[model samples]
Target: MLGTASPTRAWLLVEEPGPWGAGGVPESRLGPEVTESLRRTASALSARLLLVRRPGQAREDDGVRTLFRVTCTRGRERVLVRTCAAADVAAAAADDDGWTERPGNLLLVCTHGRKDWCCALRGRPVAQALAALAPDDVWECSHLGGDRFAASVLTLPTGWTYGRVDATDAVDLVAATAAGRVLPALARGRCSEAMVAQAADVHARLALGVDDVAALRPVAARRDGEDEALWHVDLADAPASAAPGGVLRVTVRRTAGSEAALLTCGAAQEQHPPAWDLVALVARQLPAG
Candidate 1:
């Protein structure tokens, strides 16, 4: 209300969906789960104000000088509302609320990079749909470092990356993420600091082990669901032993399966264990990402 901004905040209103509001924009669905999650999160955070809309509203600056505007529809009636940003337009979806809800960096990126009819493809639809639904969260990017993946929306708070998303599932994705629920099909996975720095060596390829290396790939991992249990891994490597001169010949493995488990294995590799760290011993016989 006084500073350079108005504390990024969002105001959400529950409404039914209908046809295009005005500009012939498409429609966005507010699936039951998505809607419930949004409400739950908004209530938990005590959100005072939020912009609400249906899909198909043009997500852009229609010329509101002060706050950010993300429009949507209530069955053909074009609805335009102001975003949280009290100063900068980019803070539209934020700046007003107490900053409690997660997905910290809520970014709606448009992956439709190439300036051609293709730009209007899925990327544009995603851009417009998200813009209409959560327009303030819209972002213009050349690329998110992937091919055919036009936009990359980075939900603040958690750095989960989703690719190939479009207008249709925008609401579902946003709502699911806000609820801290894992959208397995949507996550691009997260790699840890240890995993990023690992370039371990293969010490000895043991034959008398409980498991053997088969196929390996660089994977981002983490523990989830009932298995507070770490990931279970299956690895294979060439038969090897300590170097004739002295050193052992082992292969470092790239991991898959669970993230927490992979991290556990990666960490174990550091402790030069005689046999305690099974992951390190097993990893020594694989590849890297």
Candidate 2:
């Protein structure tokens, strides 16, 4: 799951109190017109729109819903919140004036069982466990991709994602996130970056023993030569003994899997997913002016 984080940097999480269908928002109670409108608005903003519901049986849509708009841009990360009648969700999301900036973060657990059984079976427990620790900050959300990586969790504003997480791991992750640090062991990648940059960022962090969320930053990424499968990524490290210039470069290669495998329980046929490999890592210091 190294570079598998969803590629969107912006998200519009609309509270639906679902039992969402396999298609997520489009198949929910919000009918085609509203869903289409929302899809258009989200697409215009380059945002991912997902349905969210509170954990447990007590959750019921009371006509009014809370919405969260989050952008995970590296230096300008922010979360905005607003409450509106369920019918006005699309309008509210498109309106920029009424939103208020919110502090803290959100933990979205993928539990859309209709999309994939592994998600509901494995993700529910993680969501419940997380809600027990921070009720207001956790929600059971629709499909987040990578179904085989069940019990997947996505932290908002930061866009840090984790997979194969259990109840214990959930607690630790919440604590780590609250403390503004990333638990690298279970991390998939950050959604704010491209796949190559995500893989390189994870590698750089572990290589430098850096866990602080703001320590290692992706400076630039580019395809290597004419090969689409090869990439070179540069990250700005916090001033450290390893590099006086605080720069690290990582090279990565992408390759298709050798064999097809059952990736999701809902899949009709086996499929092969691509893999990313680290080619080289170098820390270089720049000349002083």
Candidate 3:
């Protein structure tokens, strides 16, 4: 997988795996159904997703660069897209039939290009660790974080983006997301609007200094003084509060089984508004915490 998906030009599209396609995203990340979920994620944030080469396939774009095209689907319906990334062609090997590939090969990206501090320095280790853990799936990106986050790891099979991830969180994240778990809270930052909401809710709970954050979202905030990012989530029918008989009685472990950062915060909402950020804020006022 590594050999074919060139790290230099591979454009990894990190977004929330959708439940078919409400703007193309899932209601809640599939956790218990890790083995059964297969989402068709898109490069929502970008106008065009970078296409990697198909395993054993290649093409030239106006003679300047080689491109690859491939398709994957949630079920029988397949989504079509392309990438000028040469490595994408080989990323095909990362594909699995489902059950056996929990944590399907990973593609950890450490590029912080989205942020002003996104230098090769921060992205280097993220790339190295991902490569070391899932060499076949890992690809040191050219600053994909698109933010100042120290590190960001996105799972290839699940399209879940665990932000503020540290070298330590790698193992658990790789295992959980690889298995298709819906890591509640932590500002999901998966680039998937839904996931981002999840992350913010979790962060909001942390900020208010409460743990009973039932279906919370950051909405928007000025992080410890970093870029203004956004966060969102939907425990819509959550319990009135984290109390008995409450609609939601949730206990989310922001950290993955591996104990890494999973530091999902309102990283995105801090900078911009998400699809449901406004709704989340209004809901937050209801005193659900």
What 10-residue stretch in candidate 2 is worst by lDDT?
Answer: 237-246
Using TM-score as the measure, what is the rank order of every candidate, best first?
Answer: 2, 3, 1
Q: Which candidate would rank higher by TM-score, 1 or 2?
A: 2
The candidate maximizing TM-score is 2
Task: Output the worst ten-in-a-row residue range by lDDT, candidate 1.
Answer: 1-10
Clashing pairs in 2: none
Q: Which stretches of candidate 1 lie over 4 Å from their true place?
A: 1-105, 115-120, 191-289
Scored by lDDT, model 3 comes in at 0.35
* Model 1 Cα shift for residue 138 (angstroms): 3.3
lDDT of each: 0.33, 0.85, 0.35
TM per candidate: 0.33, 0.93, 0.41
If both were scored by TM-score, which would come out higher, candidate 2 or candidate 3?
2
Best model per lDDT: 2
